[model samples]
Target: MPLSHNPNLLQPRVPILNWIADMGSDISDEIRYRLCATLASSTLPALLGSLNSFCITLLAYARLQNTILLYIALCDLIFGVMRVCATNVSWLRTVAADLVVVSGIGWATMMAATMVVVGFSDDTPMLIIVVASGLGSCAGIIARNYAAPRLALAQVIVIDASFKIPFCIHHPEFIPLILLQGAGFIGVAIWIMRQQRETTVRAIAGQIESRTQSLQDPLTGLLNRRGFAEKAQSMRQTSSTKALLYLDLDGFKQVNDRFGHGVGDEILRQAARRLSICLPNASICRMGGDEFIVLADCHSRQEAAVIGARIIQTISLPTVTSAGQASVGVSIGISLFDPMEVDLERAMVEADEALYRAKRAGRGCALLHDPAMSGASKAMA
Candidate 1:
């Protein structure tokens, strides 16, 4: 199948609903989902960010009798509550939202504390404590959220600036030294983030590629049986009608035996191409060997008949490949299905049985499954 027809790529995914997506349009949904899953599943990072900030802010509020510190402490408590609720409700989806909001609250706590120390000019122990905490938060963002590079970089910049701005303002003589050290810190953070993001993206992409391969028929580039089942699982509709066509290429063995397997493989690929053209909106599958299956929306037996006959005509021509030349006829059995009465398995089996009838009647036609047809024919006999 062409890459354009591959459904697995660029499909819209609900951010895992309760545990799904977290990235923006800049990032792919698959990457977003995996990162969300990783962040949500881990409790230590979020727990540390919330508890550490809350306890420190609450402590400063109680000791200084500062009303601003109390509000910051409450904001920290709210972030902690959000993290806890996300973890308890879903093990994978809320951290990205929590990270943004919590990072802001943390910066406010640090900045307010720094402003208080600067105003007093007392050079109390609180200034040292505030600076230490701000540095820790910046480091934590870089280390814990590296996979989400943009968020980490933005948070680090804001949180680091909160307390740094106060120090830069107070002592003009120390500006040069502080700027040099800050540049070095940023450079190292960028280097670390780049390395980690590359590794994480590669890992997630490999897993997705592996999964797509498993559900695929590598030879014809069509969905395999399992792949068909997976797609059908998503299409179950009680109110809608669908037709399942079980198809087999007649004289395939003769071509394989005479011209060799190379020509046979080319013939199969050509047949798949023709099916794709005939049923542009249908789910087509190569069920191993020369057998293939298709499921398409069908409103009536007449529609099923038309589809089955069209599939036969579309692939009726002799195929000429670089390997060799061969001609093969097709046999198709169609079964109409609706999710209300029966499931996919039963529909598949009915289609197979119809194909059996088509082959028995002579191998170049289409047949719709009708149990009563067999009984009526027996009565005539």
Candidate 2:
């Protein structure tokens, strides 16, 4: 029953315990420090699971000198505890990314070393276990850092090299076979990194396209009502002198009823274009149907009136389409913002009231909101 006579035990002439020690010493201090930092940012659950399993396996087998096994377990435990504490510190969080990556490399190196040391007499079993575990670690790195290909690549290189180099040095006769396997793994890693890059880019592009569609109108290519409000809110916070002009297209409903909605859409597009030309600095938005809003910076009430008049004139111009010539006028109501009284909602209501007054005074005119005009219109009604 003695395993001392086993042929497989005699085959491994090279001792791996000394090789592991030499490999650890060969790593530069700077590289070791970086690896330690990376390990600190790695996911706590994954690290804990892998480290605990390896420690338990070593204990079960009663591997050479329980002292070495205990040292390895203690190192992993200290690293995990440091990482958990780092998450709560502001400065530590800044370097957490580097910590996670370095820590992963370090832990992987330790696992590879352990495999070689414990399975020195069983080369075939060691090869299988080491390759499988290396690939699994690579997959985990991909899952965690797929958005960052460079980081994932670095981790993969460290992991695969740790196993491959030591194995090649020990069994030079199997160099060709080992090189071929390493090349295959490198190919797989490259493919995974490329896929991750493409996926990240596509996701970012999709999000941008979705946001653009939400903020823009399909027909006129102007900002929609929601977009205008968002922009105006930010502008209002910064600027003290501002004006709001509410415009309603006159006889637009009749055009839709007579010529069809297709032609009506063309008219709206043309009107938006003309409004943009008239007020180049203004933020213009189509507030659904035939209503539009313009936010502009103005020095005085006179400047607001002038801008409104220009908009009305441009919109009144004949719109030539495939369905012949069509003319639609615009009624504008102006409201000015005062730094002392910053009430956007009240200004909007006043502008709406003035728009009605412009329509009542015969279409295609601009009227500034006045308190006296509102009371007069109410009394007359």
Candidate 3:
């Protein structure tokens, strides 16, 4: 019979679509937030400059009208691009050459409206006003780009409101369109921010399960070989004294041979439980079969030896068996790290050698090795 499909068979995960949606949302929020800040910061100077230019342009000769309007148009376009790039691309790049031409146009327009250039006339009060206004607008733009966007945007809104009275009196037709555009941009930014928050939450949650699985041993709930290796390497780097003990259950093969494989598995499980209990802080790992490794941060070589001896003593105790009573002993080899010889792989090898010595000495013994001195050789003999 065909096996029935179970929806629960598939482990729960954050759907890819949801993750993508969230990422998009977060990016949009960041963009909106930046845009708001930029606009707010520049608004005051922009308002002062725009109003000053608009009034001067009205008072100034028709001969200068073309240049002034061109400058204002350029300023608007330049600022629009700056806001876009700052929010959507690089958040921190304050000086953008791409915006230079537009800024130049805005400067020219502000000059045209305020100071009538009948000749090379630098002495006029109107000319001074125009230059000062242009500089203020430029300063605002720079400040907005460099600082937090929210404050900048708030300033812009205030300046824009102040300018609206004059703007309506002089050119009432443009006010409605400008307000609509600003509102639409803000709405889009809000939507994007919502998407971004959702995405980050999902991304963080999805990574948790993946990391847990990687760090955990599926069969025994101890650290897996990979996790053990990582901990050993970390300990080797930061620790002054570290010990790795390699353990192999004595007569494990005979147990597998005499009892069924299931009974042998039960014994291994029981062994793993006892080892975990004994080495609470140490990273305990099953290196497949009956071999296991424990990486411990010990105060001294004697401490490592004590831990190894305890492991052997614990595993040698009587274990409840399915068919009858069964007991097993563990042979353990421990290697303490020296400042000179602290390589992770070499430490493991020395520990393995010590374990071999313990197995040879007797099935139930523990052997400790110091790379600075002789290890287990005398005991084995």
Candidate 4:
């Protein structure tokens, strides 16, 4: 084709390509999908740009009757139609990711450069139009594909070659001036793109870090109460029945008073570690201070009781830390209910009631709350 004249090609001045590429894919499959997506982003821009090029090249060919111009027009029609149609089809984007997307960008960059090179030899009026469109195409290429610096720079080089080599040969006296202008243009574009990428990366990364911190307990490396509630919302949609375990550490305050807060903090960390070990397939959270909660798929009272006993026994052992040796016990209250039917708040209330019953029965025991028991039933651990 001649050269793209789409004004909207310049609209995407932001360094979107660099930002998308920086959000790296941890999985192998994602890399291809990301590349395909990036290619898809240029669909509208390329389509519009190609239309201008296609129309002008046809006009130029009609007037000059040049075989090269005719060939360029054909290339524009085929490349433009194929890219626009393939991208719009979802399966084609993923299935033929490497073949289509990589080749598409290759075809596009090559075609743009070819137009810039051939169009320079036209008459004065057509040359002016070609020159203007070529500059616009170069800017669009640099702005949109800045994510891949190699590709962006390669495109700029090709375009600069098309313009510089032809103009320098024709006007031997202006070669020095042309070279200076081209070099300065490329250097400035590179600097601006690098700065834009850094600023965008910092802004997005900071937001993600802040959100992650809000949902975590800094002390025990477990979910906080708010985080637990947020997690439970997803559980409510599942079909399985689950149990809520409300735990309170016994003799924690006495250990803190005797050994200072350092040893107490160590004890708390050990407690969290023990809970994770006991309930490996469960969501665990440190409620506050010595209280904690667990959500797991528990079917019956006997299974819940066995789990509670294991937890109490593990937590009761002496935990030796750098500060000192500290010993503590735990009381567990388990309530089984359908998460979808009863909800987390109501289930937690029942677990809390059962927790008080466990404390009353013995400091190191488990209790299952039932309306019929009236706080009479307890599992001595």
Task: Highest lDDT: give the candidate number.
Answer: 1
**Root-mean-square deviation of each candidate, in angstroms?**
6.6, 14.2, 15.2, 7.5
Over 1-381, each residue of candidate 1 has an lDDT whose tens digit, in order, gives: 222222221122433321211233555677766665554444467667667767776766666777776777777666666555544543323243444334434444554454454335454566677667767877776776675555566666666666666777777788899889878888899899778767787899899999989999998988998899989988865468989889999999988988888888999999999999889999999999999999899998878878877888889887887765678999888888786677999888888887887888888888778767751111000
Candidate 3 minimal-lDDT segment of 10 residues: 1-10
| Minimal lDDT window, size 10, model 2 | 1-10
lDDT of 4 by residue, 271-323 (tens): 99988988899999999999999999888777787888888889999899876
Which residue window of length 10 is worst by lDDT in model 1? Answer: 3-12
Give one digit per residue, the lDDT tens place, for model 3 in 1-381. Answer: 100111111111335312211212333443434333333344344445545555554444444444654554445445544433433344323332223223323443434333334223333554455445544653453343322223223333333333334444556698797678657644554444445435544554456657768987777777788887776666544746777788999888888889888888888888999998888877889888888888777777568768877887889888888957678888888877753456878888888888887777866877777555655432421
Tell me the TM-score of each prediction against the true structure: 0.79, 0.61, 0.49, 0.70
Give the per-residue lDDT of model 2 (tens digit) for 4-113: 11212111223431222121343344433333333333456555646653654365246345366566656556665544544444555544444444454456556655
Candidates 2 and 3 compared: the better one by TM-score is 2
Off by over 4 Å in 1: 1-29, 36-48, 77-124, 237-239, 373-381
How does model 3 fare in lDDT?
Answer: 0.57
Can you give the lDDT of residue 213 in candidate 1?
96
Superposed Cα deviation of residue 158, candidate 2 (Å): 2.5
What TM-score does model 4 achieve against the real structure? 0.70
